[model samples]
Target: MPRFFKQPFFAWFSPSPSRLQRRQLRQAIAHIIGDQPSNLDVYQLAVRHTSAAKETKIKGFRESNERLEYLGDAVLGMVIAEYLFKKYPFKDEGFLTEIRSRIVNRESLNGISRKIGLDHLIEYDGQRGRLMPARTSMYGDALEALVGAVYLDKGFNFTRRFILKNLLSHYDLDSIISNNTNFKSRLIEWAQREGKELRFEIISENGSSQYREFIAQLLVNDEPFATGSGYSKKKAEQSAAEKAFEKLELQ
Candidate 1:
């Protein structure tokens, strides 16, 4: 057995009272996933954020959900791509790609994770004074880690079923397809159709290097149509475009 699996802290036969907590955690995870996990430690690690991680002697590096997140990201993309290909056989690649992006975006994933109650189960070091404010993306990252754990414990097919039955079932695909919110693209298309110039300008930047805020302005024919702020230039532009799209009734 691996050192981590042999550790008394995770040993299934440990006589410590923590054994009860571990059992309870396993049950909770089984309930959430609708299937029993063979390697409970992997799932436990999935919910653990880097802020609460501890270094291991074997790896000399902290163990957290990041690695699982990367794996799950690729798995999720593949599953989603396969699903879109099957669902929309006639749809062009651009449409499929755009829809996939919208579905897998950070905000969408965060919302889905929250809806599935994954946010409540996440373990992070919130008490650390130096830790940055909890980001919504953490919940999404944890959710991805959970997917990776599921894939490892169960398999790819089971992971796909979990995503389709538990996660995607909660979303209305018809509504999502009908109500595309690529405001920036829509605004640009509208501008091109009307033979008007459209541009985005970064008006200001503020905050620390780690968490800088950007303000963006959307201009139509050199006239400012709307202004918005976000954590990144792309986000700010998207917000500005959204506001402009709504105000101008472009859609």
Candidate 2:
């Protein structure tokens, strides 16, 4: 069993887990992550959704998994890129890129996060409609945040191993390769075919240079249709396109 009440942030601001709750949280973290965490507070923050930022709000600063999500997004991209690069030594750049996108894309991660039961552990505001949409990305974002937490607590090498063992195992690389999901291209083509204007606008960009985050809104005939977020402009657009494509029922 892992130690409890290990960090001040969690003990003070966030929901104060009881002795039993702390024990349960520690056990849950170990069980879900397959390793005990050194800092319990960070892990708690990882599952914290943006809507509940105010609840765990620090007096002088903002608190949410958003920053960690950005870090994890970058980490995930790099680690997965390296994995695909080495795994497909003979494959072309486009092939590897597409496969990697398929793996890290919002939809794929959402499914994986839900399947892994990360949704249940997330501390979010259910009352907030947009924050908890019907088909929510909250769980997926939490997963990325959780990855960030792992990276912070255990470092890169351990995080890499954890991803390979826990996350990549849920995926079939061959199947991902077989599927052709170029949402951006498809959406552009649809716009051209239907004679409708399509644009992906970067509405916001925030965070430090190391882990900058992008939020994109998809426009159809100059109207906002869907929005998505990622660590890069291209990634944000890709995420936006995916959401728009699904919204349009193009699939």
lDDT of 1 by residue, 1-251 (tens): 11232332223222222777678768878987998889998988888777767677878788889999999989988899999999999999988998887678776777777777666566666565364323447878988999999999999999999988888887778888898687899888888989999999999999999999999999888998899899999999999998886577444
Candidate 2 Cα misplacement greater than 4 A, ranges? 1-14, 54-60, 182-243, 246-251
lDDT of 2 by residue, 95-168 (tens): 88878887987778877777676666677665654643336677679899999999999999999998888999
Give Cα-based local distance difference scores for all models: 0.80, 0.80
Error in Å for residue 192 of model 2: 18
Q: Which model scores highest in TM-score?
A: 2
Q: What TM-score does each of the candidates earn? A: 0.68, 0.69
lDDT minimum window of 10 residues, candidate 2: 1-10
Q: How many clashes show up per model? A: 0, 0
